[model samples]
Target: MSIIIIGAGEVGYNVARKLSQERKDIIVIDKDEEKVERVAETLDVQAIHGSGSSISVLKEAGIERAEILIAATNSDEVNMVSCLVAGVQAIVPVKIARIRDPEYASNEKILGKEKLDIDLVINTDQEMVNSLLRILDIPGARDVVDFAEGRIRIASFMVEPGNPVAGKSLAELRKDYSNLELVVVAIYRDHRVIIPRGKDRLKERDLVYVLGESAAISQFLASFRDRKGVAPPTKVMIFGGGNVSLLLAKALEERGVATKVIEPDIERCQYLAQQLDKAIVLKGDFTSHDLLEEEHVREMDAFIALTEDEDRNILLALLAKTMGARRVIASINRVSFAPLAYQTGVDVVVSPPLLAVNRILQYIRKGKILNVAILPEEQAEVIETVAMETSDIIERPLKDLKLPSGILIGAILREGQVIIPRGESVILPGDKVTLVASSAAIPQLEKFLMVKLEYW
Candidate 1:
């Protein structure tokens, strides 16, 4: 199957890189020669320096043979036009666009099946805000992803030295906390990801991903928190007046939280003030340490840096943490900057591009694949998929299935009940199973799901 990706920007580049690694036929189109060159040099895919919305360029990129077309340009108009042109020129089965404009996103008729026929519309800003809210809901979690309609959650937490589960093996933890309904799926330590086993030990500063029912996950996470009890942030100070910050402020306001936004641009601040009813908008430079101090940054329950500047966001987040803010979240656009930001003591790093890529992957992997959540740095993914009758995984106990090394069955949703799988657990056809697989093991996983040939 041929896939045509428009725009060689972060989102487009990431999607192309992933698909190319999976050995899919990918062709990238970008008007910018430099970005097109970068994609051609780095990825084993065809790159064309041409406008995505141009009919000639679509033909040059072989859109007629493309099974999937992804429009990820920064301009909403360009993205929409690319999809329309693809629909007109080819029988592309799926067209996904990254739409940022609220006006276009709110109007279903404009992008409906009768109109644009877009298979999936990704709103990066809204997805980022929702991800932030989920992280905020779980106070100490580094990342949180919901599956099975929020019944199952894959939450990542940093294992502190003093935490109860810090130095314990998964087997010991299972014996100690026998009633807890959570399973350790993956562990990230020293920039390496480990598909954890029963004997694997969780170390300090290790980012551990656990999967289970919502309540069980909460009970499991409680062990990572201190006795003082971490409460949800009641007061949030956002350091940008962009669309994402505005949306997040509005959501927080609905939850009755005191939200404040500081922006350097006076006009933007004025616009934000007019748009927001309860959230306070202040016109000031985020670089001014005195201004932040004057606003009692030390007393804030959470400090968020959502500015366009990645360096500024990381530095401000670190400064906020140093100023005694309870939690600091930074919006990083570059995937390479996340580990460094985390090393600098930033509580959480949210990447909009990565979030967009994750959403797009869900649609690209058709039938039986219900959802996909890509872990940080593309180290791993937690996939929620249904067991198909034609697959070899069903009607047998999990242990006898001869699963690959870097894959773990996190949870099984049968009928309405959630099951934490064990060696004796059997997977039936039509059951929703969540699997955590390392990046190296994804091909094996696709083979097991019997979607290897279908994916291409």
Candidate 2:
């Protein structure tokens, strides 16, 4: 498919790179010559140095034949204008824009079908806040992605040395905890992803993704924690008074959590103080040992660094972790810096670009797909798609379907019930089937989900 992306910033570049890897015909437009040059040098897609909001520029980039138009420039006005121009020029099948302003994003009249005709609006700050809230819901979870309206959750947990299930095979765990309804979909170990089977054993320090009902997943994660027990964080200390931090603080206050925000800028701090209801806004550098000490950082349940500076966020997160905070979460904008930050002892690292890309991909995928979540490092994807009557996957036992390698049917949501699939399990049409597949198996999985040609 022909895709045109407006912006060569981190979000746009990452999206272009992913689509280019899939061999899609991509054209990226950016006003900055340096950003255009970077895209041209690094990615295989076409890069044009021009304004995306200009009608001439859109036509020059082949907007007439483009199937998808993504306006991800930093400026909300530019993104909106780009989409408006694309709609007027060719009525692109899918128009996605990165709208940062909550006011623009929340107004349906402004971005409705009769307005900009945007198919999707990606608000990075809101996405970040939602991610933070999900992570905080589960104390020690490294990552959490909800599907089926929060009924089904895919949670990532690191196996500690003394964990009871560390060295047990999947089969053994099922036999041991037969009452618990959960499936171990994938395991990340030694920088490699393993699409685990019944015989695969989870080792210490291995990051495993488990999928099941919310309560069952919580029960499973409880075993991985210490005997002392880890409670939900009641107090949070946030560094930076940016949009994301503000949104998170507001959410925390609604949850009745004690929250404090420390920002170096006086004006931003004043603004935060006025906007927040119960959150304490302090004007002080987070890097100052004295300020952190005075605030009693060690007593905080969680410390979050949401500063614009990637380096500073990582450093402050590490410092907070060392100061005895129960958990430290850092907002890292650069995708490449996430792993390094995790390695440096940050409890959780939230990447805005990755979150935005995942949402966009979910919208782009074909079929009756409900939701799509790509696992960390792009190792695998957990997709929730509805079964079609004409599809070959229905009306047969899973074992007889011959699913591609590196793919596992994790769960099936039928009506209001959840089913953990086995060899004898059959998938009926209209059931919401969740599959975990390695990155290499996505194409085959998509093909397998397509309706039979004879049915057409």
On a 0 to 1 TM-score scale, where does candidate 2 land against the true structure? Answer: 0.97
Q: Model 1: per-residue lDDT, tens digit, 74-187?
A: 999999999998999988999999999888987789899999999889999999999999888788888999999888999999988788887899999888877977798988
Candidate 1, number of clashes: 0
Error of 1 at 214 (Å): 1.7
lDDT of 1: 0.88
Query: Model 1: how far is 405 from its true place, Å?
Result: 2.6
What 10-residue stretch in candidate 2 is worst by lDDT?
447-456
| lDDT tens digits, residue span 1-456, model 2 | 899999999999999988788788999999999999999999999999999999999999999999999999999999999999899889689999999999999989989998998889999999999989999988889899888888888999888778888899999998887787789999999988898999999999998899988878877787668743466789999999999999999999999999999999999999999999999999888558788889999999899999998899999999988888889998887788877998888989899999999898876666667788888777788898888777776888988987889889999888878888899999987888888988888787767665531133
What TM-scores do the predictions have? 0.95, 0.97
